[model samples]
Target: MTLNTRIEAAIDGALGRATAGSVPPKLAAALYHAVKPGGARIRPTISLSVALACGDDRPALADAAASAIELIHCASLVHDDMPCFDDAAIRRGKPSVHAKYGEALALLAGDSLIVLGFDVLGVAALENPARAGRLVGEMARFTGMPHGICAGQGWESEATIDLATYHRAKTGALFTAATRMGALAAGEDPEPWTELGARIGEAFQVADDLLDALQPEAVTGKPAGQDARLARPSAVTELGVAGAIKRLEDILSGAIASIPACPGEAMLAEMVRATAARLTPAHTATAAE
Candidate 1:
């Protein structure tokens, strides 16, 4: 099956299970709204890519892992757009979940997706118990506290912030999980894959920093100038536009260099390059020469 098709099927099945039964129609609609027509699907795509690169022994398990990662990501976006966080009105060019579904339902939907992510992995355990267990542990570590996205969120509430730590947890953790889990699912050692994911994650954040700084809501499909408005630390804020662009290039280079040996190494490298190209922001036409 095609990669996109595989991903969509996994996500569809998971969401269907959670929101099945017509008892709470609005909630189910809201859940579908939060996930349908997803943005990029980069995290899960990376997960599946790594699995392919490492000899996809258990594609079903990899699909579950990828789906779980994406569900968590979607959940985070739903919460992040709420009033308590970014307060974003638009996402993927549509009204944010809270805007469309109200705060209570949006909150509930996000929570439901988060739990469903693990449920997908748990179902996969029925086939391959050990690998499924490892995948769940990896997802938990990336989604929860101490060293995951939760830690990244916690950093926002602290008096002092460590830029690297915050960036890694907030953004890099899942990408890191993508690589590690992909390898683990493929029956390969996951440690060697960490640096590649970290570099790509860092590159992604830097690119996002640029888009958040320079791109319009029309182009970005979300609110612009968020970093400055929200007082969030950003590479664009720290390094300036040109400097941030340079940093993005550097991170992409490191990510390319960090790919571990595999039968599909060349194809994966090409995918990374293509992804980097997509992530790289074009210089605005109206900006100074």
Candidate 2:
């Protein structure tokens, strides 16, 4: 099957289990809403791509890794858009869970998705215990504590902030998780893949900052100027528009260089370049001058 098809299928089965019969109606629906119409699916795409590059011997395990990574991403977005966080009214250009359902249901939906992420991995364990176990550990590490997206969010609450730490956790952690888990699932040493994930994550973070700074809600499909409004540090705030774009280019260049030696190494590099091109701010016509 194609990469996107594999990803969506895995996600569909996982979400169906979570939202299936005997579940609370609204929250179940909210869970579905939070995950559907997935935007870009970049993290999982990277994970699955790396798996393919590494010779995906076991498609089930690789698909599980991709789906689980995506579930975590959806959970993060649900929490990030809540009133306590970004208070975003729209996500992927539609009403956010909390906006449509309620804060309580949104919170529950997010939490459920987080747990379901591990569940997907657990199911894969029946087929390949060793690799599935490794994937679970990797996802857990990046989903919580000092170096994950949670840490990324925690940094925002600090009296002091480190830009790199903030961006890495807030943005790069999942990308890191994506790369590592994909390798682990493919029965390859995951360590060699970390740099590529980090580079891609950092590039994505910079690109997001640029879009938030330059694009409008109509263009970005989410709130804009949040970094400035929330007093949060960002690439644009640090480097300015042109500087941030230059920084994005530099990071993507490094990302291309960081791909590990694999059968699909050239293909992976091309994907990174495609991602970089996709990441260019839509307002570039105005921002680039």
Candidate 3:
């Protein structure tokens, strides 16, 4: 099956199970809305790609891992767009969950997806309990606590922030999980793939900074200049547009070299290049300038 197809099918299957029995109907629907029409599916794609590179001996496990990573990402977005956070009205070019549904439902939906993310890993646990267990632990480590996305968000409220730590936790955490989880899912040593994921995640954050700084809502499908408006630190804020763009180039520059040796190593490197192009905001700074 195609990569996108695999990711979607895995996601659909998980959601189907959640909505199948008696449940809060609105929240169930909100869960679907939050994830469907995925934005790039970057995390899952990396998960699957790393799995493929590692032979994907257990396809079901790999699929579950990818879907789980994506579910976590969707959950993060749902919470991020709530009134307490970015209060973004639009996500993936449509109303965010809290905007379309009520705040209570949106909050519930995000929490549900986070639980579902861990639940998704159960699909292959019986097949390889050891690998599945490792996947769960690794995912948890990156999704919460001192070094996860939660910590990333928590840093925002601090009196002072370490920009690098903030970016690494806020964004790099998941990409790191994506690569490691993919390798773990496929029964490979995940350690070697760490640098590639970190670099890609950092590059993505830089690109997102550029997007938020320079693109219009119409161009980016979400509120722009949020970094400036919210006083959130960003690449564009730290190092002007040109400097941020150059930094993006610098981050992506070493990504290929970081890929661990594997059969699909060349393919993974190519994917990073393509991702870099896509990361470039639609509205070029020069065009706006």
Q: Show pairs that collide, candidate 2.
A: none
Count clashing residue pairs in model 3: 0
* Candidate 1 error regions (>4 Å): 283-289
TM-score of 1: 0.97
lDDT of each: 0.90, 0.92, 0.91
> Candidate 2, TM-score vs. the true structure?
0.98
Candidate 3 lDDT over 104-197, as tens digits, reads 9999999999999999887668778899999999999999998999999999889999989999999999999999999999999999989888
Candidates in order, TM-scores: namely 0.97, 0.98, 0.97
1 or 2, greater by TM-score: 2
- Highest TM-score scorer: 2
